[model samples]
Each structure stands twice: as C-alpha cells, then as structure tokens.
Target: MTEIEKHQYDVVVIGAGGSGLRAAIAAHEAGAKTAIVCKSLLGKAHTVMAEGGIAAAMGNRWPEDNWEVHFRDTMRGGKMLNNWRMAQLHAQEAPERVQELEDWGALFDRTDDGLISQRDFGGHRYARLAHVGDRTGLEMIRTLQQRAVALGIDVFMECTVTDLFKDGSGAISGAFAYWRETGTFLAFEAPSVVLATGGIGKSFKVTSNSWEYTGDGHALALRAGAALINMEFVQFHPTGMVWPPSVKGLLVTESVRGDGGVLKNSDGERFMFNHIPEFFKAETADTIEEADRWYDDKKNNRRPPELLPRDEVARAINAEIKAGRGSPHGGVFLDIASRRTPEFIHKRLPSMYHQFKELADVDITKEPMEIGPTCHYVMGGVEVDPDTELSAVPGLYAVGECSGGMHGSNRLGGNSLSDLIVFGKRAGEAAAERASSLTERSGVPDDVLAEAEAEALAPFDSKGAENAYTIQADLQQTMNDLVGIIRKADELELSLKEIEALKERAAHLHVDGGRAYNPGWHLSIDIHNMLLVSECIAKAALTREESRGGHTRDDFPGPDPEWGAKNLVLTLNDARDGVDLVEKPLPIMPDELKTFFEDK
Candidate 1:
C-alpha cells in the first residue's frame, strides 16, 4: 500500500492559471479555506502566453461601445451557439472585472484621455480590448497572482490530480493527486472543487497550448458524471510560425492583424476578400480600399475580411495554401512591415519582434511572416450552469477554458482573457457558498483511494514493449492529420479507430527509473486524459454533420439551420465503458435581445 498524505480545504481549486488564481482570490474573500493546485510553477501557466488583450467594453476608444453591442457581437461570433446567459453575464460584468484588475494595481496601457487603452479585434463592433501593448496576458496573470499571494491563499505547485472522488450521495468529496517531483500519493478533502485546468490543445501535434493542456479537467468532469458540450468545436488560430521547423506551431499573436497588419499570398494577392462567407458578408469589407479605410474609421466602414472570425480566416488560409498560392513554407504571408512604421512595431509588438528575430531569424520590420493554422483552444469542455459555473455534479464547478458554453462553437480572440476573470470569479463565489453550506468535509473512501493508488502505480509495474512517448507522439499526429481544422466523417471515424488502438498501447505503457521526477510516468497518466478528450472531439465532430464555427466538415460543407438550433451534449455511459452523446435545444433568446440580429 502506498503511503498517502492528506489535506483538507473548504474548496480545492485545480490549475493555477489566470482563472484559478482569480478563483482562489474570490473564494478566500468569501471566507472559504481554499487551496490552488497546479502542474507547473506559479507564473508559468498558458495564460502568461496570451499576447493580445482582455475584451471588455470600456468604451474608451469609442463612445458608442457598450455591453449590448459586445453581447450581440459575442453571440454573432459564436454563430448563435453560445449559452445566452453566459454571454449576457460575461458582457455585463467584464468591464467591472477589468476595472477591478486596475484597482488591484494592474498597469494597463492608457488612452490619450487617460482611460485604459483599447484595441480592435475580430467579431467586436468597437475597439474593446483593454491591453498593455502585446503583453496583456502577462500583466493580467501577474496581477492576479500577486493578489492571491497577498490574500494568503495556499497553493500546491507541481502537483497533478489523477482522480476526482465523490461522496456517498455522488457530490464531489475530494481528489487523488501526486507530486510531479516525487510521484508521492496524496489526497484532497474538500466539499467543493473548482476545475480551471485550461484547454485540450495538447491532443494535437501543432498547438500553441503548453504541455499542461492535456484535457485533465474535461476528462475529470466526465468521469465524475458531468456533461461535456460542444466538444467538436476546437479553435485553430489562423496565425502560427510556419518557418524554421524548430518552432513551427508557436503562436504569432493576432495582435499583428488587429494592429493594421495585412494577409497576402505568394502571388501578392489579398486572398481573404475572395473567401468571405455569406454569414459575415454584410459586415466584412470586400475591397482593399474599403478594408484599409475601415481600419481608420470602423463605425463608418465595414471590417476587413482579414479580420473575420478565426474559423473563417483559418479555413481561408488553408484553402489558399492548398491551391498552391502559399509562401515558401506552405503558409500564407502576414505583412506588417509595409503597413506600420518600425518605431510603432517595436513600441506595440516588442515580443513578436524578438520572437521572430531570435527563433526564425526573420526581421518582421522588413518582410512578411509565413503563418498557418495551429490548434489553439477548445470551445467545448465541462458543461456548467451559466450563472453559477456549476456542472451536473453539485459541488464540482468549472471555468475558463475548461468549461463549455461561454464561447460556443468558436471563441473570439480577446474574449478568453475576459472569460477567465468573469466566470472565474462567479465559480469561486458559487463554490464558496456551497462549501460553507456543507456540514463537514466528505471523507475519501478507503476503497477509492486504494484503487487510485493501484492505477497510478500500474505503469511502473509494466515492463511491456510499449513506449509511452511513442504512443503519445502517434496520438498527436493522428489527431492533427485526421481530426484537425478540416474534418470529414471518414477521417473522424478513422481517427476514432486510431484512438482506440492508441488507448490499448497506453494501457501497456512501460517506463524506466524510479518514481522520483520521472517524466515518462507523468506522461503515462497524461496520455489517458488526452485519448479520452480526443475521442470526444472526433465523435462529436462526426455527429455534428455541418460546417460551422471552428468545426468545418468537408463532407457536410456548410451550416444547417437545424444544427444551429441544437447543441451536442456528451456524457459518460451508465456502465462507464464509453461516452453517449445527445442533442439538446439551444436556450431561447428573448425578443429584446434577438432584435440585435434583426437587420441580418
């Protein structure tokens, strides 16, 4: 039997990114004894990699901008697949959250009139993203981390939770975890658990997400009897490094395009104008003259087709590349040098300037960048109530990238940072309230702990022929090739079959060396979560049968009105052997709110 260390908290928050840190702070303020557990160091979360800005309708750049326009834009961006309540709440509260961050000492870039400076982003009617140049996420995370530390919140760093335990009544009891450094077993006893474990991007080979994004929260929620919605919707950001094989999938921030950059092909043609879909035709500029003019006066002129939602841009880029109009590296060109001055480029995008200079040895000040699509975020995750962030499991809550419905089929560029603060705070408040109401912490059953220990130790016992890294690599390649931005039923089905085979290989995975700081052993567990999430995505993609948002189907080709009215929900089968998916009607939009789309 493994020796198990035990700890108790009123609420246990998993993943210490922007959302988890904000959640911990909120839970503490609500008088809950909260602890945050993470798989990495305190400041190294994926949120720190965010380069654009946080979307909040502060109206600093334009007086006409407000929450109503923001809300309408969010819904439209999502293709009307978003949870109405979540979109409403996010738009209503994001400004207050941004102001609160400022109150907490975050130094945002200021406008000429001394208000927080705002920038333009796709699917937004106004310059609504408050930023600190191109390092908005770094500043946001730093501010939240400092605030949480000042609140004296407890954080368990370099720890990974393997299993979420439940009480006799099926409410969340606690979790089974292990230290990444030592692989020692431990248990968390809490009445409530907040999962902010981020996205599932690590499932794909080409991704901007870090290794920690292995879909732990999505798998954990499903195993604990919670539902997952919109699993088919995975965002493939249009711009990623395509040169210098070493850093192929690293992100080239959308801030480049947001700040007057233009997209061109090998033929020196602006191809985005030719690929504009009917869905956004009315709002997008078709001519170069109109696109350039829109950058200066957005209210009077339509947005550039290059600034379309990420899905449209990604697909258009992929098509351009396939048609043999790509750059030297099989990707389209993003030119900012000819558009903006060197001084302005350095002042606004210092990180991007340094990234290309050091990594690819290409100076953006002089030439265009070769960029292609990269899997960036999963719009689907654990389904939760829009107001409380509570999943079907009563005491289990989810927020940020780990939770579904906020972004629906596709997420807007700057909305992710805003989602973190808005829903993170809501999840924390609701979780703390639930935790305080519980009479006592639920006990972890001895049998459950024993089973978890056995499973975690099984990889060490296997000296089998299967290599964990090889299996993981194959899995990533399979997802990237078959179930990526462009999808087909045959490919999705093939991907599912490949996933099953990989799962069998993962079960027999073997590793060498002691349990102390073993990377192989950690990967052995991570593979399971990755496979489960990948299966969900492929299966859901196969079933959707329509092209919409981030999920584009080659077979189905276009969106269907019937499909737009429903959401696909996935839940664990009763026998716990497989997943079962069902379609549910979308929440009805009120007549008043529906008026926003009346013109369309």
Candidate 2:
C-alpha cells in the first residue's frame, strides 16, 4: 500500500478560478477553515482567459438598465429554458458582486463620471459589462487572488483531485488527489466540498477553452449520485482566430464587436444584416446605418444583428462559410478599422490589437480579422439548488460553470463572469454552514481509499497498447465532427457508439514515463472525464429532437413549442453503465416576473 499524505479542513474548494476564490473567501469569512486545491498555480486558472467583461446592471452606461431589465434579457437570451429562480437571483445580485470586486482592488475602466465603464456584448440589452479594455478577466482574477491571500486561505496548487470519497451515510467525506508536480498521492478530509471546476470544452476539437476544462467536477458529481440538467446546450462563440492554424481556437473577445466592429464576408458585405431571425427581429437593427447609430444611442435604437445571442451569430457565421462567402481561411471577416478610429481601437481593445498584431501579423487597427465559431462554454453541469448551490448529495456544492440551471439553453456573453461570483459566494457560505453544522466528523472507509488509489495508479500498470494522446485526439475528432453546433439523429447515434468504444479504449489507456510531471499520465486521467461528459452531451442532444438555443438539430431545424416547455435532466442509470435523460417541465415563472415578457 502506498502511503498518502492527508490534510483536514472544514471546507475544500476545487478549482482556483473566479468562483473557487470567491467560495474560499466566503467560507473563511463564515468562520470555517478553508482550503483551495487547484490543478494549476494560483491566478493561472482559465478565468484570466476571459476577454470580454463582467455583466452587471449597474445603470452606468444606460441609466434605464436595472435588475428587472437584465433579468428579462437573460431569460430571453436563454430561450426561456433557464431556471427562473437562478436567473432572477443572478440578475438581482450581479451588480453588487461587480461593485464588490471593485471594492476589493479591481481596477476597471472608468467612465467620465468616475464610475466603472460598461461595454456591450451579444444578448445583453444594455452596455452591462464592466471591463478593463479586453483584459477584464485578468483584473478580476488578480483582485480575487490578492484578497484570498490576504485572508490566509490555504492553497494547494498543482494538485489534481481524481476521486471524491463519501461517508457511511453517503455524504461527502473528502477527496482523493495527487500532486501534479511530484505525482504524490494525497487525501483531503473535509466536511464540505465546493466544486468550482469549469466546463468540458476540451472534448471538442475546436475550442476556446483551456486544458483545465475537462469536466472533472461534472463527472465527480455524477459519480457521487448527483443529477445533471440541460447537457445538450453548449455555447459556440462566434469569433475565434481562424487564419493562423497555430492559434486556431484562440478566443476573439466580443468586446471587439461591442466596441463597433462589424461582421463581413469575402465580398465585403456586412453579412450579419442578412441573417436576422424572427426571434430577435424586433430587437436587432437590419441596416448598417442603424447599427452604427445604435452604438451612440443604445437605449433608443435597436442593437445590430452582430450583437444577437451567440447561438444566432455562430449559426449565421457557419451558414456564411458554407455558402462560400467566408474568408480565405474558412471564416468570416470582423472589420473594426472601417468603423472605429485607430486610436479608439488601440485604447479600447489593447489586448486584441496586440494579439492580432503579434500572432497573426494583422494590424487590427488598420485591417480586418478572420474568425469562426469555436466551442466555448457548456451551459449544463451538476444540477444544484438555486439558493444554496447544494447538490443532491449532502455536503457537496457546486457553482460557476460546474453547476447547471443558471444559464439554461444558452448563456449570454459577459454573464459567465457574474455567474461565478454570485453563486460562488452562495455556495461557499452554504458549504461552510453545512460543514460546521455536522454533529460528528465523518471518515471514509479504508477500502474506498484503497480502491481510489489503485484506480489512480492503473495507467502505470497497463499493457502499453493504447496511447493517451491518440485516444484523446480520436475522442475530440469524434465529438467535433458528429456532435458539433448542428446535430443530426444519425450523427448523434454514431457519436454514442463511438463514445462506447472510446470508453473501452480509455479503460486500458496506457501511459509512458514516470508519474512525476508526466503529461501523458495526466492526460490519461483527463480523457476519462472528457469521455463521460461527451457521452452525456451526445445522449441529451439526441433526446431533445429539436433545434433550440445552443443545441441545433439539423433534422428538426426549428425550436419546438413542446420541447421548449421541458428540460432534459440527465442521471446515471441504475447500473451506472450509461446516462438516462428524463424530460422535466420548466419551473413555472411567477406571475409578476412573467409580466416582463407580456410586453414582448
């Protein structure tokens, strides 16, 4: 038996992104001993990759904007598939959360009146994103990191949690993990565990997400008997670098379009104007002149077609490329130089300007950018209570991208940042309370610990037949090709068969080299989680049978009224061999809140 180092805490947070930091802080403030375990160094999580900004109805850019209007926009943007309570709470709390970040030393761009300046993003009704150029996420993460350090929260960096342990009563006891640096097995015995781990974007070939996003938290919750909802809705951002094959899926922040960039095609036509759907007909501008004017007068004028919800824009871009109107590199053109001044472009989108100039050799201030749709965010995750962020499993909580029902069928741009803080704090507080309220400390049985340890070391003892990288590449290709933005029943069924075969391959996946700092060993673990998540997505997409939000079924090309009334909730079957998606009615919206849509 290999000896494992063990530590104890009242609350343990997995992931060091925005949500994890905030959760740790909240747990500490609630008078609990808190620890954060992350797979990367502090401040290096994917939160820093966010280029757009935080969404908040601060009424800074448009004074008419408030929580109610923001709520309406969010619910509308989600195609009414959202959990009404979560959407309401998020809309009501996001402004205060943004203000709290500013109070904690986040330096956002300022307006002339000394207020945090806001920017427009797709699906937002107003200029609701508080940002610092195109690097808003960097500022937000830095501020949270400093605050977490000052509060004295213990951080175990470069530690990957492989399994979650449960007590005799089926409650969370702690987690089994290994240090990524030395590959030393370890255990964390905590009464409460908060999973702030992000999404599963890495499962797809073309993705704007980083390596850390492999659905670890989602799989952890599922294996621990938690339900996942809305697994079919995966956001495909409309703008990712396409020309340079090396930086293929690098994100091009929507701030570029928010700051007056327009979408064009090979013929230099502003193609977005020609792709407006009836769903947003009343809200989006159909002409170039109107769109340009809306930037100056957002309250009175309609938004541009380029500012439609991400699902709408991504589909339009895909249609354009398929129609042979794409750029030389198989993408549409995003032209900011033709609309905005060079000084303005450099000042407002400094990071974007440099990213294009240094990487693609295209001067964004003087020319256009070539971009295409890329898998960005998964709107589905472990289903949790809207108020407490508690999963069905006692002592287990989730927030941010790891938790489901917040964004529903589609997540609007800029909403992800706010979702992190709003629920992170709630989950942390709840977790701390749950931990402290326990009458007795729980312990994991020795057999469970031994099993987890053996599973973690299995790759080393494998026959060395299957390469982890090859399996991962095959899985990514299968997902990207069959279960992409547009889906079909035949492809979805094929994806399921492929997933079953991949699972078998993953079972015997082999790794070379010692465990210490071994990339191959790490990938072997990540691929299993990715495979599970991909299977869930494929299963749910096939069950939906209709096109809606981020999930588009090519055979059923329009949103069905019947499907719109229910959400697909996924759970592990009795034998735990596969996922079962059950259709559940949408939570009824309260009459007062439903009035917001009466006018629309």
Candidate 3:
C-alpha cells in the first residue's frame, strides 16, 4: 500500500459553495494560507441553484427599512426561536456584506435611484431583499469565486472530506480527503477547519437541493466530537414543481410570488387566506380585495396570505392537496402567467421559466405553474455561539445551512443568502484567528489516520454485493415516508430503525469503479453523510414533541412553550449507529437584542 501524502495549511474549508467560498476568502484575508475542498466543480456548488435574492437591509427602496426592522421580522417569522445575537449580527452586517459583494463586481438589480433593488418576500416586514432579478445565488457565487481565485486560495474541486482529524485532547486538527479525478488521498493538516458544506436536503425524496447537499459538514463535525443542535427543524420549500414525476419536487422559486404571482387550487380559488398564522394576522388582509390592495399599496397594509413563512406555507399547501383541492397536476396552481406579460415575468425569473420549460415541458409565460413543497433547508446543525461560529470542539467552525441557529425554527425566504455571507465571514475570521493562536507542532493522531484510511479504501475492498444505488434509494424513500412534512412518534421510530438497517447495508456496499473520477464510489461515501444526518434529524424529531417551525408532529399537534425554550442536541452514540438526543438550554440574548425576539 502506498503511504498517504500529507500537506500542511493554516486553514481548510470543506465546501466551495457561497459560504465556503466566502469563508476561504476570509481566511486568506486573515493572513492564512487557505484551501477549499468541495464535491463539485468550481462555480457549480449548490449555491448556483439559489434563484430568489439575498436579504439585506440596504434601504435602497425604502429608507424606513433598516436592520432593526429586519431583525424583528426574522425573529417573529421564526416564531422567536432564533438566536437573538445571530439575528442581530446578521441584520446589522448584511448591508455591508452586500455592498462588499457589489464592490466585488456582483451586479444586483438596481433601483430608479441607482442603488440596489429590493423585493418583497414571505415573512418580511418590508422589502429587504437585494436581488439580481432571479439568479441571485449564481451572481453572488460567481463574484465570490472570482474573488477567491484572485486571492490565490488553493481550491480542490470535486473532493469530498471523509472525516476530520483530531488529536489526543479531542480538538480538531485537520481533515483527510481524496481526489475525485485521481484515487489519491491527501491529508490536510491545518490547525483550523471550517465546514461550509451546506445542508441535508438530499435526505428526503422530494427536494430542491442538488446531490451535493447531503449534510457532510454536520456529519464530519459530529464524528470529530462536535454536537448538532436543533436537527428536528427541516424546512420544506413551499413552491416546487409537482408534475411529471421526473421533475416532481424540484424547487419553483418563491421569487415568482415576490414578483406578484398568486396561488390557486383545482377549483381556481386562492387558499392561503384560510391558513394564515395568528402572528401575521394583525398585518394580513381579511379579504381578496384587501390582499390585492395590500399588494398594490405596501405602505398602507400587509399581504398576509402571500407573507407566510416557509413552514406555514408548506403545511398549508400539504393540507390543501390532502383535501383533494389540489390541481390535476398533484399541486396547486401558481398563477403568474395571467398576472403579467411573459417578457416581464421572464426578466424577473429567467431560470424558473427555463427550468419549467426544459424539465416539465411547460412555458411559465403562458401557463400557470404547478408547485408543491419539497425538503429545502435545515435549521439545525453544528452548535455554535452566534458571534463566533465556533462549534463546541476547538479549532472547528461551521457556516451556511450546515451551521444553524440563525434561522431559528423557520427560515424566511432570502435570509439564507445574507446568512451565508455574514456567518461565513465570521467562521473564516474566527478560524484564522484561532489557528494563528495555536501551534501546529504536533501532527495528526495515528488512530485518526488509520480510521480515515480504512474508510477511504473500504468501498473498493468490499465484495459483499451491496449496491450503493439501491441502498440510497431506500434511504430517500424511508426519509420521505417516515420523516416528511408531517411526523408522528410511530413514523419517526420506524424511520430510525430503517436508517439503522440502511447504514448496516452501506458497510457492505461495493463500488464498480477504482475511485478515479468514479461517481459511484463518490456516492457510496456521500451516503454515509446522508445516513448520519438523517439519523440526526430523526432522533431530534423523535425527541421534540411539539408543532413549531419546520418540525410539525401530528401526534403532538400544539406548540409547547416548554419545548420551545430549548435546543435539541444530538450527540453520537457508541456504535455511531445513531445519535443521543438531549434538550440543551437555548442561548439567552445579549441585552441589546432581547426585545427583537418579540418577547412579551
């Protein structure tokens, strides 16, 4: 056997998406020789899939819109379960971060006065999202990628991290990874590691996320001795294509509604009015005329039906479909085609139009779009203090969807973009600073290296006749059936059992390729990440017996204040078969932002 080659760096970033790119850039700016390793090509990380816009309180459209109001909306929309500090910091810094993107050559849509244009979104108190029509994520990522290349940060594309290396004291050391193009293992010995590996949307059957979003960062951190918090709260995007099984469950951008689309059922009736939460009731219009009037005159009133948070909207849609009010296409009608000219609609949501055309063979310009909820974002991840982005483990960090607490229970549309920018930079800065303070005199532990090597080669060596594809299919179906939009104790228990069985099957999974650019082998490895993350979500779901945010349990139909006051913690058990769930105390906000939570 050939010896594994090891290289040293100040910091290693384990993703190349929006947060990973931004984190790598920040580490480099902090005087660290940083490198980014990801599972896809440069500029192709799932960040490119975000179609809506970035939430920022730039006040370009309305001067009264500021970070304070943004913070209030975020906390209230999330039902006040958000970390007050992270929310405050995000609202305060997002404007500057957005401006920085502008300085880096990101071309957001412009207002009449030449400042960045803003758009209305669900759960927002005002028009706070800075956008580039649609394709905002593509614009942001492209800009960041350009900046990262210019900074000369080493980028290893199409690489996936198997595990994080830790020393005797259990502090994070670095990571071990293999090249997808070549079957070579290279050890990255960095004092600090930042995991910007995104979310676990792939754990479900219907999802807007791509193949790369398998919660790799959370899995890596958990194995390396970090804790994941609030894994129960998984966001289901309310608007995804729901017809033609092939394109079913793919996200249809919420930006369609932001641009003035409306939702209708089979009988051609607007239904969001029947499901408006009490929180938005004060601002919501009671009638269709009122909703339309509120839409036309945003300054005077509010559009409650169109303004529900993702969790509420998704649940509402699910209820409608279950009641047989769904359109013939197994979804509700998103009627934008009749609301505006095709030219204007295309300008606002170019990719949505193109995606529907190519995948569903429908033109959004002339037809009402069919949409339903799909697993979208996760609000649970590596536990961190809102300001530092540091996990419980030293020298470890997390950002983006993989690191949670920013969105609280429910994530507002558009906030994820700015959340990535704000916290991604924080993690990079903190990791670089932490690395600067530490000495890398001691090398990687022997057991850690041995375990990593075994993991890296096991797929090739396994001749047990298990198919990774078959196992992966079962996993997705299991998660979808047991842990989907509506949950119950019996279903969650079965989901855990099914995950354990699937994981057992994974050990014997045999790949057909020799690792050199072998997608099959890559998937075999990725399934481990998916299994671990799905378990985390399952175990956390089993523990939290309440209907709050994204975690709605049918058995426990009401939101309990006692359950609401804590974070769900998932720690790895002995066999790594599953995680141990615990209810940890939620962080008390600093004095300045306490009122923003809307506490009575």
* lDDT by candidate, in order shown: 0.92, 0.92, 0.87
Q: Write the per-residue lDDT of candidate 1 for residues 317-405, one digit (tens) a residue.
A: 99999999999987999999999999999999999999999999989999999999999999999999999999999899999999999
Clashes of each: 0, 0, 0
- lDDT for each residue of candidate 3 in 213-274, tens digit (9 for 90 to 100): 87889999888788998999999999988888987878787888887888888989899888
Clashing pairs in 2: none
- Model 1 root-mean-square deviation: 1.1
Worst 10 residues of 2 by lDDT: 292-301
**Which regions in candidate 2 have their CA more than 4 angstroms from the true location?**
none
Q: In candidate 2, how many Å is residue 368 off? A: 0.3
**Candidate 2 on 404-513: residue-level lDDT in tens?**
99898999999999999999999999999998898899876677788998898899999858888898899999999999989999999999999999888888888778
Cα error, candidate 1, residue 12 (Å)? 0.6
Off by over 4 Å in 3: 445-448, 590-592, 597-600
